[model samples]
Target: MFFTPLSLLSGLSPEWQLVVWSLVVTVLISVPFFVRHFSMQAPHEVTPFPFLDLPRELRDIVYENLIQNPSYPPCTPSPKALSRFGWLLPQRPAPSTSNWVMLSNHQVYEEYMDLLCKQAKFTLTVDQKNAKERDIWPIRSETLKQIRKCDLRLVTTSKMLGAEDPRTMPKDWPLRDKICERLRGVQKAEDLNLHVRAIGDPLWNPLWVWYHASQAFKDSAKPCFQRITFSLDTWSPGENLLARNKEGQWEWRCRENHFVATDAGQYLIREFCSALYAECQDCPRR
Candidate 1:
């Protein structure tokens, strides 16, 4: 016969039932205490949010969409600096919502930075006159170590510099040399493209001018870039500034043929073309 609690209690004497009920009450009262004590000794468990549970690829896509392009203020004279040096200063990129997510926690920040520095291409502008105020290398050293490709835009014109000082001439080799020296510390970069903006004189041979300018970064030692391309910007107004050519090379179209196509340029174009074709083959049109 199966004995249910009701059947067992019914079989007990009235006094025995009262004793059993008291014992059951005592056990029930102590059970919560025992559970609390054991739970206190165990490690706390954290339930991850739904977003954190997403796949890595999906999370990266989310981060990419959240990342905003930095806004650059037009180079203008600060009142104090204008009074002191009588020249405009090169402005740093205005604070933006670019890396806000990276400020959350150490692990998340590191992962975000890794994706940004490794896979993304960064454009950095350097003005010779405002070199002291504006930094060329904006990313932290640790982050920069992960960068593989960089575009260094050099703005060395008199108008940008805000003075016609002969010493601060655009063609001065010392400015380029200094910039190259600074770049040598970026030892992990594989490719460096130099985009130069300068007022060209009619007497100056644009090819030789750009060649000498690029020669500063041809170092084989530290921060040695595997490939380098130099392009001259004629600063044409209201035109398509940057475009990819048939060969998959990003060309800065100038009104004049400012860039003298060298072996380096050809190599850069070929490499880009190969990468494009490889990507196309890997992921063909639907």
Candidate 2:
């Protein structure tokens, strides 16, 4: 028979009843704390994952699923960088979740970083302001060495726009020279993209002048690019900035051949076309 506390205490003396009630109250209060303390002390069990046991091929697939972004080769000056310029500037995207996942362990970190460096296409931006501070290659040489493809954006200052001939650019124009110097260190690349905005100036007008003035295309000895793509800004329809020749090499050509009927224009076009073929021939592809 279960006797309630009130019923049991009813038969006891006043002093005895008071002592029993006090004991009951103490037990009730202590029970929760006792349970909580033991719960805290008990070790949590973690389920083991056999990720490391997987084959290298399978692990690469997993790494690619995690880290390879669709909008890859994302623009730099990340959100953190923009914060320094005041809140008015548009916020850039944060690093992908894969970046944080790499921090899980040293093994994962090394493997993921290696894959990222080798496979991912990187955008290398060089501006006059940042070049002066010697901050062109934001990443280390070790990481840069693994890069296979690059989208190079060279932002020229307004003052540079005034130069009629890029070849005759003053000695003070060290920014372009500095960029070229840095590029010389890159051992190889599958594709090198030079943006129209970067090379677009009064000097590059008529397109033929690029072969004579641009150092990157002029120096065939460098032999770094397997394929060099120049993105052009054009309003004309059916105007292709590049076309594959009979020999399978990409060549720059103006669609409106009759438009450039002048003897000088035709000669310049021929020179540029010939130079393009030579540059492609010299660049070794692996």
Candidate 3:
């Protein structure tokens, strides 16, 4: 067997040994970095997507085509109707298409929402019977800020508004007040149409209710709307009564019923515009 001489390694000075070890350590540390630097390939070139670069009108058209109808959950039927029917009726189903690509990103979603607010007749139903802050949760604050038009539907029951009782007012008046406050805070809404539906005696007038509600919005310091329309929906009997006259001739009678803004409601709207003019006059010039 060949024996290596220990003298060869042992005879080296401590300085020489340190120098050799330092060189070895340096090579060991630098090799991996050099290998990585040379071995890494350049990132793959990204393909240019021109969809975002299109004109705003063309982009809007593209987004409109991509938007699918929102899948809204079925509203629960009234308890009285359910009890009368003895079973719950199935609600209309939403479309089955799974493509909601427009809602995939924030930018496209905003575009779609803006289109809906501007072009479509978006309806927000507020059930005054079950007055809840969450009722308005379907609308986002950002959307509210950008709203150019709004159609607000307020549904009230006899019990909700105390329509049956002439002497007592609604117990949930504060909730209605809160809802008006929220509407007042919408800083960009321009055209507002309010529809009130009451489920009680057809003779139960809603003029006072409409006036007060409109007044609440008009009195806001920073109202966002220029035009407001108020309309009320009341039950109208569809049948006509036929009676025999004294001369033995048949007579037909029908009651004329229509849904339109009452005199007081129109007056309140005029007052609202006047108030807005007054406020504008008081403002300091920009």
Give the per-residue lDDT digits (tens) of candidate 2, residues 1-286: 8998788889899999889889989999999999999999999998989988999889889888776622323455545555465578655665666678688899988888788767777777655456566656766666666666776655544343335554454434455566666766556565665542333455365343233324333333342333333333444223323433444344454432211211122234556555433323232442
Give lDDT: candidate 2, residue 12.
94
lDDT of 1 by residue, 1-286 (tens): 6999979999999999999999999999999999999999999899767766788888888778765433122234355654454445554433456677888788678778777766667666776544554455555667656776677766544343332443333444555555566666666675655565554645443333333344444433554444344444664322212223455454443223232232233233334323222222222244
113 in model 3: Cα distance from truth in Å?
2.8
CA RMSD per model (angstroms): 17.2, 9.6, 18.8
- Residues 62-175, model 3: lDDT tens digits: 766655423122244455555555455664443434336445677766677777656544455667534654555465666667666666666655444544553344334665
Which candidate, 1 or 2, has the higher TM-score? 2
Model 2: pairs clashing at backbone N, Cα or C within 3 Å: none
Instruction: Rank the candidate models, highest lDDT first.
Output: 2, 1, 3
Cα-based TM-score, every candidate: 0.47, 0.55, 0.48
Ten contiguous residues minimizing lDDT sum, candidate 1: 275-284
Better of 2 and 3 by TM-score: 2
The number of the candidate with the highest lDDT is 2
